[model samples]
Target: MGGQQPAEPATEELTIDQLAAKVGMTVRNVRAYAGRGLIPPPRLAGRTGYYGADHVARLTLVRELLDKGYTLAAVERMMSELPDGALALGVFETLVSPWTPTEPEVITEQQLAERAGIPHNPETIAKLVELGIAERQDDGRLRIPNPDLLRTGLEVIKLGVPLDAIFEMLPKLLDHADAVAKIYVELFRSTVWRQFADAGLPAEGWPEIQRTLEGIIPLAGQALVAAFREAMGREIEAVAYEELGVAPDTLPSTG
Candidate 1:
């Protein structure tokens, strides 16, 4: 009879083979990890060993670390230092990952040239790569890590802001941006990280620390944008008052 004898219950435990298949790992690797004490030993029922959700979580984390290029020894070190490796990984990822997440887009060299309105310009492409607006691929195409940033830069160039001038200002702009970033990071380090450290990094606190870390990125971006907007408005008003002899208050608002 081909009748499915009712599906396995959701919370049913898995055997070694079932666990291996569930997590996409070979039984051998699961056994090896278990032997190395990377995962907790399975529950025993007479002669049979059973694994549960905890085993799944641990194995999944191990696989994720491997995929992220961490060596076994490094992962072991991490596991030893942080029993809550998954939570720690969450905070680590939030801090190290790009604040502005975007889907990467790749373009052929011809497409790149067309977009920037500069035909056959390797130097321009190089500059774009240098600015991190694009990455030159092994296959001789450009990978735009941030397509929106690339489009914004192209629009600036269209507005007659010479690419060379933008390139010239880049170093100073980057240095200033770096300084601003340090200020924000320092603020967090001085307050949040310091308190967490002083508290001996209690297991109960990592969640709050991780949430604060996630929040700070958008907060920092918003603050920077607001500050820059205010500064730019003041500078433009001053320029109008000086050059056109119009009172700063009398200038017509573009908006």
Candidate 2:
């Protein structure tokens, strides 16, 4: 008789809730993806279904691709071609998860009005939505995507800046920021990421690449602040000396 085959390793199984939590997605989204065939159907045991490591890895890959601007159809096509073991949830977690100082906060319309120091006016809420500063949910609660920015805007309003002026200037500020972001992203892609890709993107260097990307976040913020200050200083000096009729030599040193 042939020797009994070695027992296969036991695989860890996760319930639907566990799978959703592990992948940072909602249970509804998990079901939607499964229904759309973007993910493999979970194994059934009795009345319940169970997911495994492959499901987690696939979900992470899907999220990463979507975050990179791929459409759902494109994501489905790409996911179909990925060979088994091509993705690891652990690696993708470190690489794709955002490192941010702020988390989204949900507030009722009344609470939002109190925060903004305004009456419960639909026009004001509409303006906030138009600026992409807040979103209105089906439940009628407002979602502030970044509390820091909301606080900053509220402070500006407290400083007696006209709300209309503030809203008008915000779009211009966003436009400039978008351009600056593109420049830095392109710089990184053309330099560090390009070299890594040229090297065939070795798995060994992935951690280093992730660290480098994380390190650049704060550095980029500092650089932007420094540059903005310098430009503002130059503009103030120009307006003081030329437009305001003040002598350049009489100007106070910004240093």
Cα RMSD, each candidate: 6.0, 6.1
For model 1, what is the alpha-carbon lDDT of residue 107? 95
At residue 172, candidate 1 shows an lDDT of 82
Query: Top TM-score: which candidate number?
Result: 2
What TM-score does candidate 2 get on C-alpha atoms?
0.72
Worst 10 residues of 1 by lDDT: 77-86
Q: 196, model 2: CA deviation in Å?
A: 1.7
| Full-model lDDT for every candidate | 0.82, 0.80
Q: Please give, for residues 1-255, the per-residue lDDT of candidate 2 as tens digits.
A: 899999998898999999999999999999998898777888999989999988888887888778768899998875664443234344445444554428799988788778778778888889999888999999989999888888998888888898899989999988997899888879888999889778866667666766787777668878988998888888888899878899767888764
- Model 1 quality (TM-score): 0.67
